[model samples]
Target: MPFYRFDHAPDPVEKAGFSPEEVPRAITAIGADLVAGMGLKEMGVHFHRKAQLIFTLRGIVRCEADDGVWIVPPRCAVWIPGGMPHSAALSGAVEIYCLFVDPDAAPALPAGCCTVAVSPLLEQLLRHAAHMPVMYDEDGPDGRIATVLLDQLARAPVEQLNFPMPQDPRLRRIAAALMADPADRATIEAWGKRMAAAPRTLTRALTRETGLSFGRWRQQLHILIALQRLDQGAAVQSVAQELGYESAGAFVTMFRKALGKPPARYLAERRRQDGNGAD
Candidate 1:
């Protein structure tokens, strides 16, 4: 697996440049050389010429785009549209299965960054795609695999695992503080006072910038960081407390609410799809 490293990015030491001529007419999968749990300290925001699926094969990878940051666990993929600047981090041991698809070749792929849920069938298809030669026959078995993959990707559920970051300086300050310590469950009024901004002003900035109210925005941050910690093998109770949850059950409820499953159940399923249980 070879990962393209681009020189345009000051970080993510690994990069490569590709043009449409460099890729297949449809989808091309490159077994990216991502190590388990190793991340580029900082990969300056960059984009791909082709829409990319940063699919996690093992462990977790966290990525940040212009709009938000997402923690991608096993069997989870971050779908980034072509030309969308984004950067990624490997919080823990993480392996990547990269798929680059031309929108002209597969119109069903989303034009924005999204967290895609990988079904069992889709995962297998992606596995096959990863092993495909750079120039696979479009009219052959690989072509059929690519076709099914597009359908699966198009039909895959869009999961709410991303936390959109606010761009306003004041809001960024507030967001930064909360992300530093999700357990700091302070009131908006209190936070505003600490930041020397009016509560009303803070609320307006948060809503206008991120389209998320102050409270919802904080919860979103909590979700993003909590997933990172949990994926690193933290105990549920500890993670709950770390994120300001009253108990493990409270954290589980929130996790289920946002992602439709508790940490244990989710990780179990991840492991099952991760080739530990079955192919």
Candidate 2:
């Protein structure tokens, strides 16, 4: 089904206890969904009234928003401000929880879309909040729970996981090819030959539009893609090879330079912080 319009998408939140005056704002995580690959129904962009925080429980989920394409792995989520058009892409099986908030009541969210790191406290809180009703009491346990959750969300650290896409058609060509095959090792000159624009024009457009050199932009792309592959339980060596690295050592160097740690160590540290690993 082609649901390009905002009205096409179903409303899952209002059905609960949500209303105009009872509780001006609320949070819910009960209706989580799991999927394998790009499901067409939710693939297209959808617009809704309330703000959203899409968290990944397992595997990786890729999404395109107003700012750019975000690489959402486990332990992280994308904050979509209310009334924005966004679309998602899937590569494999992924588990997810979507948290919808009222901007008026919860004004702590970023004014624009961005990726946020999920701390252990926030992770468990969202999991627990999923069971409560939509319009839980405002002065009881549920209310207190909601208040704490909101505070945590506002304090959650935002991550630099979004890969901004270039708007120029020329750069788009190169960008699309790289995304389709991250292993593509062709030079800009080589790619420009097939594109309508000249190599120099494409290079300049990339730098001007994205404020990043051609090489730097591709490296950023690789890292975002790397995060996705790594989240799928892929071995570091296997991912390096698949991404066209000359050697595992070289790939690790790049990963460390960009993310401040090697793949295994970084993930392990994240797990430890999330209290999923041994203390």
Q: Which candidate leads in TM-score?
A: 2
Residues 145-223 of candidate 2 have per-residue lDDT tens digits of 9889999999998987777788877677677788888888888898888885688988888877778877777888888
Off by over 4 Å in 1: 1-21, 33-41, 269-277
Question: Weakest 10 consecutive residues, lDDT, candidate 2?
Answer: 1-10
lDDT of each: 0.74, 0.74
Models 1 onward score TM values of 0.83, 0.85
State how far residue 47 of model 1 sits from its true place (Å): 1.3
Candidate 2 whole-model C-alpha lDDT, 0 to 1: 0.74
RMSD (CA, angstroms), candidate 1: 5.1
lDDT of 2 at 25: 51
Tell me each candidate's RMSD, in Å, in order: 5.1, 5.0
Q: Model 1, residue 193: displacement in angstroms?
A: 2.0
In model 1, what lDDT does residue 80 have? 89
